[model samples]
Target: MSKRKIHATDIFNLISLTDPQWDKHSRKFAFVQTTMHEEDNEYRSAVYIGDLEGKTIPFTTGKGRATSPRWSPDGSKLAFVSNRNEKSQIYVMPANGGEAEQVTFCKNGARGPVWSPCGTKILFSTSVEGVQDLQQDEEEKKKKKHPEPLVVEKMRYKSDAKGFLDEKNDHLALLDLKTKEISLLTDGDRDYGTPAWSPDGKSIAFVTNLEENPDVSLVSDVYVMDLETKEKKKITNSNGFYSALTFSPDGQYLGFLGHEKEFQSATLSRVWVTKLESGETHCLSENLDVEIGDVAIGDFHSGNVNPGLMWTEDSEGFYFLMSDQGGTGIYFGSLDGAMYPIHLPDEHVYAVSMLTGTHEAIVGVSNSTDPGELYHFDLKSQTRNQLTNVNESWKNEVELCKAEPIQFKAKDGWELHGWIMKPAGFEEGKKYPTILEVHGGPHAMYANTYFHEFQTLTAQGFVVLFTNPRGSHGYGQHFVDAVRGDYGGKDYLDVMSAMDYALESFDFIDENKLGITGGSYGGFMTNWVVGHTNRFKAAVTQRSISNWLSFYGVSDIGYYFSEWEVQGNMEDKVEKLWEHSPIKYVSNIQTPLLILHGEKDYRCPVEQAEQLFIALKKQGKTTKLVRFPEANHELSRSGDLALRIHRLNHVKNWFVEYLQKA
Candidate 1:
């Protein structure tokens, strides 16, 4: 049978595998398998166990979403977070397969369960609002028929993901298995997360911003707490953002991934190991130019927990994920500050679980065509064996396009990386209308990952070209930080240069019927691109930024993000912000633009799209705005299934309407 061409709605049929966890003593490993419930317009996930021999089976089942699977120290019990009830709570079951038991009944909810070294306790995070009991909190919430007036006081009062901020703050709690008692380990207005237990179980290391006004600062420090004395010591000074806390096997060093805000968000996160005895800190990946965590942006995967510092049994070295040259790979780092690649394949390794005392690991790998799957990887041999085919059925039914990697020089002679996907069922000597796709983040790389949007566009007979420009990660620190203060300057030239290189090098591309699209930072670029030049015939901007002046006050991270990226703020560089804003050049746009945005997006809020659409319509230039209700900035990635489909269809239809036909 002939395979069918991929469609925008094909996302519903694909499965995502993430958060792989290996049982220390056994060869078996468990991973979270997520699939879209099309009928319900929701995603359902369950934990599945897979062995090195390639056999896989579900460990958790029935309806509600389950995620963050973690094995106990003895590998006898499995702990995970599920939403089978009204609120998501922790569930623990025997690793050998039996009935699972709900472990926590926190009033707000509980998640991110970390099994204690002794297996006698579990460390989890939950939101708390003071000394109120669960019953009282529920009763108090029920009494309020309507939500009370949200009196916003702090600058960080809302988030694109969590919505409006409440009085409750996320705090760490300790659950005693034998006594069935739960105790709050840390409390107050400050939020805490990413908890790691020492091998001896006497102390816990977690990440938090203890600043009095943490809403204004971006610094997150790592803190270690003594369980017996409840004494807390700050390991990192208030200098940068830090997370992914893990204790070495020997309990002598606390390893983590962080940056010193040298380049703000564009700074490469290095591997830092702090000696507990002398308080000496060392950056293991200081010499490496690649980003220390997974920065490959894709739309298919869900709940992809980065395997930060997976230390070996000897504690001399650890494994980590690094993004370099448009791909994410596994690398090893030693205490003496040496780094080496373990498996640097031309694919995306989203999650990994290394077996103790061995070089073998269960890694979740994905590429341009494959959605994602679990693989038993041998780090020493640098070989991988497929262990699970979660998206096999979808792959068999649909014909996917593979992206061919391309390298070219930017306008200023700097080398850049990107990929081009040929239109589905391409014929020789026939020129195809091409769409230049720009990824968001401006700091995130467009790597060799399964991007549903790219496939859908290619299936619609449009060549998709995506690239990592100056602001993108995986490149050196200087390249990543190049676009910080020069938003539409060199970054714009880089993308335009990519299009120029593609048109000059490839005979199959139709330069006249060109189109452009992007979201978030990419959206901002799309707007900027159209306003600056009429090179493209069509454009689609999603969750974009238009005016830096208004963006600094409206967006959730706008105040700081604008200050960091635009190098200006309302206070000192007001004129500079306007000069860099795309809205300032609205009258120059000639391309027919489609403005797509989430109604509830706080990152590049809907108003950004609204401002652009109104300006275009007032000028009598072709433009349309489509907003997805109840959606946020993540509409393209992890939003509602129906909304995500609608978003893809809107983008595909817009490009097809302007770029295709006679």
Candidate 2:
């Protein structure tokens, strides 16, 4: 097939494949497929079921989203959630073939369903309206007037997507199949998540933050409730982050992904197991030293539930995924604390499903060239077979850059890893302008996954480069925590060192015409780079942090994120915060900069971008600000479809004006 240049518009055509679940008795596999609707800027999801060797067909079809498909205990019914109406509601149908019926009708709607072991009832999570709020709403409806003002008293008032939280918490509800009645379970002024039913069906395990001030304390514990007695037993302390909870088939052990806050926000999620008899809890992956969650960040997939711990039928060992060195791989962990990685290099295993009896697995993985697709993996043989060709159109049409791995030593003697992507069409004698891209999280890695923005830049004849500097996951504990309190120190040199290695080792890269860009922490680095050096001609900072001092007071994480990562607090460490802030060095910036921000972003609030843009503009330095409405920290990854393309255009044009030849 002849190669063609890819565009940002192609983003809509991509179908995100995720949440593969297997029906053991029926031998049918179901997964969620989502595609973007450009006009309305909405992503529509549908559920699909396929056999091992038969054709794949859509089980539910609609313009609305239908996701999180799960087969019942008997394999006779499929349960899922759909947003066919305003809010997402639970729905179920026969697993083999039948019309899906909406199961729950609620004001806030229900999602994330878990079926009972006997398959007679289903349980899901839904937000509960406070008694006062519900009465106020009713009064307002009767009066045919505007709603009354929301008087919220919580520490955290507004969230990113849900908007003004206003005294609402997600609680559990149990639904009866025969009576079609719902029983509210675990109701309080707290949020619950990830419900799991024990094999005996007498108990339900869930996670909740029952603290007086949940947003401030940020403590969640695992709890198991007796179905008949309604007695709850708390299994964890109020110390750290814990989620992805599951119970073994034998109901003898509890498995979950959590960290003890020993490392604060930089702590990697470890697989923890608790023996029900002894009440002894220990980390299985403590020695493995890798993040135990999805670390591959990309734009294609959204609305993913944690795969958690998938136990074998015998309950001897369990299968789980771990992130290491820019890729996610399935690993087998024994009860004896032995762990071994099932090597899946150069791929992001975003989701995985398995059959109970055998070493059979189906994984949703995406690489540099592929968007996302499911693969039939043989755990015994450690081989994977392609199960779906969902991205064939883009694969056949685009001439994408293949990433080559590179390693270099920082000036401080620390070894760093990175990848280089040459432009689509490369020639020996030509020099191409290069972009040094940085990823967010500061704790996240730049993986070998398909990045649409990078692909478009390569299509525009620019060599794109990225690296996992210190403070990035995939590396060990120390490396991922190195940037704490030393933001602009060695980590700054690590990225610049990658740039130096790229210019020295790759002859096609033009050192004189370089550009830099990043979002969140990456944006902070972009601002830092342009201020410290004039090597880059242009830069773009998106959803970025400019001043740690102001950020510590304004951002949603302002309360503690600064203290955790920047080692700064508003009351105690103001001076240190200002010292590492990029805004402090803005006067020395020589590179023309473009500031992109999401107005609704609470994490790295738009005020951060505003301060930087205002500072650069007042200094008479060349700078521009591009703001997207109703967008949050996830703007680049999964924002409004139209605005995503617009943001990409702004980025492309800024670099085109400065880096590309006339």
Model 1 agreement with the true structure over 1-662: per-residue lDDT tens digits: 98899998788788888888888688788988888888988899999988888888999999989998889989999999999987899999999999999998888889999988889999999988864532225566577486679998899999998898988889999899998788999888889989999999999999999888887777999999999999999999898999999999899999999999998888999999999989888887878988999989999886888768988889998888899998898888888888888788899988888874878888888999998888888777767789887689889888889999999999779999899999999999999999999999989999989999999999999999999999999988999999999999999999999999999999999988999999999999999999999989999998999999999999999989999989999887999999999999999999999999998998888989889999999999999999899999988889988989988999999888898963
Specify the poorest-scoring 10-residue window by lDDT in model 1: 130-139
Cand. 1 TM to true fold: 0.98
- How far residue 382's Cα lies from its native spot in candidate 2, in Å, is 1.9
> TM-score per candidate, in order?
0.98, 0.97
Q: Pairs clashing in candidate 2?
A: none
Name model 1 segments beyond 4 Å from true: 133-144
Across 1-662, the per-residue lDDT of candidate 2 in tens digits comes to 56988888889878888899998898779999888887887888899997777468999997988998989998999999999977788999998787889888776778898998889899888888653321114344456566889886654776667666766788888899889878888776678888888888888888888877776787778888999999998888888889888888899988999888888888888998988778888888888888888887676678766778889888888988888888888888989999988765777888888874787888888888888888888888878788888888768887878878888899988989988999988899899999999988888888878899999899999999999999999988988989998998888999999999998898898878899999899999999999899999999998899999888767777777888888977776789999999999989998999999998998888999888988999999999999899888888877788889998888888999999853
**lDDT score for residue 385 of model 2:** 80
Quality of model 2 by C-alpha lDDT: 0.86
Alpha-carbon deviation at 10 in model 2, angstroms: 0.8
